[model samples]
Target: MPHRTIELHVDRDSVAMGDDVVSHAGVLSAPRGTLLSAALELASPEIRSPGWSWVAVVDGATTAVWSVDHGVQLLVADRKLTRGPVDVFFRYFVQIDPAWLFDRLAHGVRADRRALEEEYAPIAREKYRAELRRRERELDGRFLSTECVDTLQHFGAEITLHADVACDFTHDGDAWSVRRADTMFQVFRGGGGPIASIRPHALGEAWLVGMLGASARTAAGRADLPDAEPLPGLELTASGGRWMSRGATVVQVRSELAARVAQLAYGRSVADLRALLDA
Candidate 1:
């Protein structure tokens, strides 16, 4: 059975404020008449409030089928495309209306309450409850921040490819792997604070190695951090592998925190890493 491989590319790694469209190009390599499906996931650092949507355009035709799942927006397209190139454009727009603010605010308050109940312990619950109440009171007059609005505007896209044939398709790359790689690199690159610890399963060790390798390459360019010794500590044992921090405060490495760590470790710049991945 033959397998298929798809390579994804973005026209610009980063865009300015006025830029409305970002071009995406993908090359699909498969046998002739092979049917395949492609989906693009667009995600932002912050959650969108309301009256905002993302649009996808292909061959000058705007896509009508789009959906959001767990804060990540997706656009899917299927075709009986042979080995060829694919192109698309993504646009994001938002409209704010004061009349709709109250409804959004009510939803946000409910969400906060649910999060507090699910995430906090009984002993610490009241403190957060009070804080939420205070925030609710403040929200009565407060407006959204420019920084918040700007963050909602910025987003990243990941392309996923799937084949319709009953053939074996294997790819080591995924959005989660990319995200983990970026996180691990940041912990090793070091600037603000290193990760408290990382507990990787047996299979996760390979990903950890790749991320460490990228961090090693990045560290070579820095004069201050000459070695990888001062970064987080990694130990491999029969049970699994662990990356530990030297500080008293222990911060578990998660996706969101990893993104923040990358930002800090890379001096608030991720364009180089993104370009490398895109290439």
Candidate 2:
């Protein structure tokens, strides 16, 4: 039950371009901060504990490491990595249909674009119009003839962009701060000495999803479907070890680390680390 880290190591002679990287899924639970701390603690070949269970997909050419943890996967290109623990937890997940199916739609390109077209299209359009009008009002009738064109141009530049962030996790801390520095949201009591920092997966909050699947019985008992009550706090009180989420989005923190320990058992590397670490 060890965390499975699907690693993709690049070869020295491998080409830099093209599909030089591969991906696989594994499981691990080392809050973002702890991961960073461990990475910093290591020298080139210090046989340290694998930090947290990791399924790493490494680009052999660039040595970029992409790790999956808590269902969130991250891409560490350019040899740079997350210096701090991510303080966000997933709010929820909604998997929409893939875009390729729309290409085969009989209705034409419009139909093809309709899958995630509604994702943020309406909001974008409205925001565009509002910005145009605001710009026009600011002109104070000085450019009446060119108002429409100016407004449109202004709108184009001012429009906001959004990504399909299904797992909406939040942290009280500043996003910019965490993204740029080495910071931990929680203290590490793992007894392995001071941790380096925690690192979260870049993917959506798959950690929680896996947890929900693992503890379906307890979660189901907590509520009914369609109206299932959200966990009020980030502190999950189930298995044993207490966990604090990066924010409210991580509504359910593990009450125990027993299940997490079991997950790492499935990974050969993690199993080896666990035995050697004697945790």
Candidate 3:
């Protein structure tokens, strides 16, 4: 589905200041963001007036109602079906209460508020991103002096011998080097045209995935709740009123692997890194 963006609009003609902006429409461009948010009750927001009779504009056009309550009676379609006394109408929805009472006012307010997200969404996303950045910066401090060999081994380089059939390997101080993987192919095939080669980084996706696969430890502790979402890297077995949290999945990275991962980007430049890393 294509993502639809909604903007709150306080009708300059209807949702006016002091319940009257017809006399002063030009002087006051009806507030749309924070100032408009302060007008609604925080818990149960509603339009102060029932004069919000305008249909919703989707991508800048009037949208037809698809359904109301998803039931048989509500499937009826007609503008007069939603009519209230003297131009009071429901452009978006009609919320009938549990006792079958028409709760038109609340849902009417919800139309634009839901569109604008009550104007609270802007500040909420800002705070969330700021906090995440702060925690990331603090976590990256552990990798300033981390050893590359140790970090590489955390992703699996210690026991992994760089063994390719055509390439002669050399290991010195836990670091391996090679001239080219296609050297033997060139000598045998008598040097073909310009060639392409692919050698994934020493510690790459396979190594990261292997670390996860080999870490299933089967924890001894049991969970108090029998029904609960499984934790990452954990399996659950429900027996008598409690759940056994098996598969602890202890990834034995020297506690600093993530920090080192952050450090590895020390010199790279990426515009949208979203972290304290220079990249």
Candidate 4:
């Protein structure tokens, strides 16, 4: 069946501070051809600016646009959208008395948490817990460097930080021989570390440091990283795949799933047919 896709352009400045996924103006409908442009031209003059932009694709053709006052603040209303289409449009005035934005962001963050937990909780409990524990131990003892924290704080856009899991490990001079539930992760110390690591169960992580060049620019644009640097160790892995080692203290990441995560983290797909040169 064909249906419409509705999306909104949101900016932090538009909503009262400390809100999640709230914006001053938004649009709905399909994203096709010049539908966005035409809709913008028909938008109210007060809500028009270049600070934020988004596209929605509906069915196979129809499209729409939403523009808003770049300077005004809009409270994020905590209203869950319906199933099929994100059918809701709100516009807030300049001066308001109540804390509407605060309520909205709180509700939105809670909703997001519920959605994510529903989806990932089972995976962690059934197939991912042991491996995930191993990875976290690696993250804390050996991999948790000032640089790693800086990188994650700057680029690692983790929406929710799960409860910390503990494990045992021994620092082996150069690397840490950490022991997880049923696995061992040899976390490297000093300068060079694992940019991305995956397990046999399609779980992985990647670190982008002083690499990633233009790809870094794209990642930063998506708020995944803080700065644009060289894209190093584009780690790729998959579930039920044999572990592929790169010789120097491989972190045992699967291949397929790693590629997908890299795309989200790097803002580009594996089949980047854009005549790319370096990371």
Candidate 5:
């Protein structure tokens, strides 16, 4: 459904070049390059059936995902495209300008977009690919300009986290071995002692809550993104709630998710991470 131009045949056994999606809506090939794919999905109600099977032959590498007849509908992978409110097509997935290829196929080609691309050079009987790659400078310039952006300086730091936490745990049912938190070494003005300990697990849990709050906030602002579950911690104006943590790690994780959301919402110009639940 993502690609309207490329014809999708419901035949799985057939091998064809440029047949983007094969039978059962499986991806067959990429648009002439290494198998740097954005995402892939192969599903079936009869997936476990002995006959239910398929393969992807991207750049001559044979690969199969689902061969079991089990009812399942899932997002098969999580690349940048999965985090997006953006299309999973060539624009973000394949990193290609969606309209540039047909720029020259405008001189009255009596067919659909696919026909314009396929018959572009061959049907006219010329060298291979006569109308591809015309505007290299313009395309590359824009892409490059967007890439080297420290654009949202404050946002960048919050999206990624660097943490150092250590604790001790024992195998369950051991009964003899006990779980333990790392020693919180203290050197007071008067003396020094190990006053208490820190639970690495609690720290991690709080950090994750903060991360989700940030991810949810940005995801909410974008019109293209689907509605996500509510984050109670996200509601607190300042400082974390009972679950969320108030620290650099939480901020960093939120920033990472926000930045990705920004990228996905690029064309629409949604310039924020904090807003209404239905922004």
Candidate 6:
């Protein structure tokens, strides 16, 4: 199967001030039988908005308007339109919550007051009152903050295409380079995934040797390390190059071999490298 790139073009870049509703016009080019999905990321600490509505305009007329809980939905088609391009125009709006707006104003007022007090103590009392009034006036109108605008730009409408083609995946030859090994261990130590849960010391010498070979040792000594707690339904041998549970093997090691061993020991235990060497 051949790999193809899909492109999405949006007409507008920024939302208009005082208007929660934004207009978007775009075209999607993809192969036939590809699935398309759209999503919007509007969650931010500074802005709060209610659900949105999407309208698909066809032939200069309103074809459909959908009330979606969030701005994520699959584009369903009766037949695949892969042979050509598809034009899409839509509008969406979010209702800003009043309470959230008020909270933001209150926090801003407090922060301004503190800054004024530190700089001008004598006039701070009067300035704080005036600042509060100014904030209220600012809140009376609809507006988007700089932060909000930047957030919108980042989390705007995103369309993704899923192709029904097999990918010829190949590992990068440098995946197990020192840098990658460092990153993998960092993520493991930080408790980023399930593999991080296994105690490194419990891993069999066979696995450690594959990862670190004779250059590494557990606190219990290199030859007589304790057996790791068995993974459910996984019968691991005391000696093997690949992890019996997941078939993972240590592909490369460098100056950081000992450190990687220590990380794997505490992060997750696995089978020994001796299996691969013996084979």
User: Which candidate leads in TM-score?
Assistant: 1
User: Residue 162 lDDT in model 6?
Assistant: 11
Task: Write model 3 residue lDDT over 36-72, tens digit each, in one string.
Answer: 1221111111343231223332224332222222211
RMSD versus native structure for model 2? 27.0
Model 2 Cα lDDT, one tens digit per residue, 1-279: 533322211112111245236421222334333443233222111112222212222322111121121222333322233332222211111122222222222223222224444654565556655655565446443211133222222222121211121111111221111111132221112233321122232111122222222333244453211222223322323433444335423222333432242232222232232222221
Which candidate, 5 or 6, would have the higher TM-score against the true structure? 6
For model 1, name the residue pairs that clash: none
**CA shift of 207, model 2, Å:** 2.1
| Model 2 Cα shift for residue 108 (angstroms) | 66
Error of 6 at 68 (Å): 6.5
**Candidate 1 per-residue lDDT over residues 1-279, each given as its tens digit:** 533643322221123455426433334344444333233332121224444333444444443222232232223345554433444444442222222322333344321324433443353445544554565445543222223122212222122211111011112321221112322322222223433233222112222332433444354563322222212333222212332333332234534324233222331113333233223
For residue 95, model 2's alpha carbon misses the true position, in angstroms, by: 36
Q: What's the TM-score of each model vs. the native?
A: 0.23, 0.16, 0.16, 0.22, 0.14, 0.21
Instruction: Give me the displacement of residue 140 in model 4, in angstroms.
Output: 10
Better of 3 and 6 by TM-score: 6
RMSD of each: 23.0, 27.0, 23.5, 20.6, 24.9, 23.4
- Residues 1-279, model 6: lDDT tens digits: 633634434232233475446444455445455443331221111122343334333233333333433333323333333333344444332222223222333344321323433444445446544654465455543222233222222322111111111001111111111101222321111112222212222332222333333322332255423334322333333223322223342222222343344333433323223322222
| Count: clashes, candidate 5 | 11
lDDT against true structure, model 3: 0.26
The positional error of residue 198 in candidate 1, measured at the CA in angstroms, is 44
TM-score-superior candidate, 2 or 4: 4
| Model 2 whole-model lDDT (C-alpha atoms) | 0.26
Using lDDT as the measure, name the better of candidate 3 and candidate 6.
6
- Residue 201's C-alpha lDDT in candidate 1? 23
Worst 10 residues of 5 by lDDT: 169-178
RMSD, candidate 5, Å: 24.9
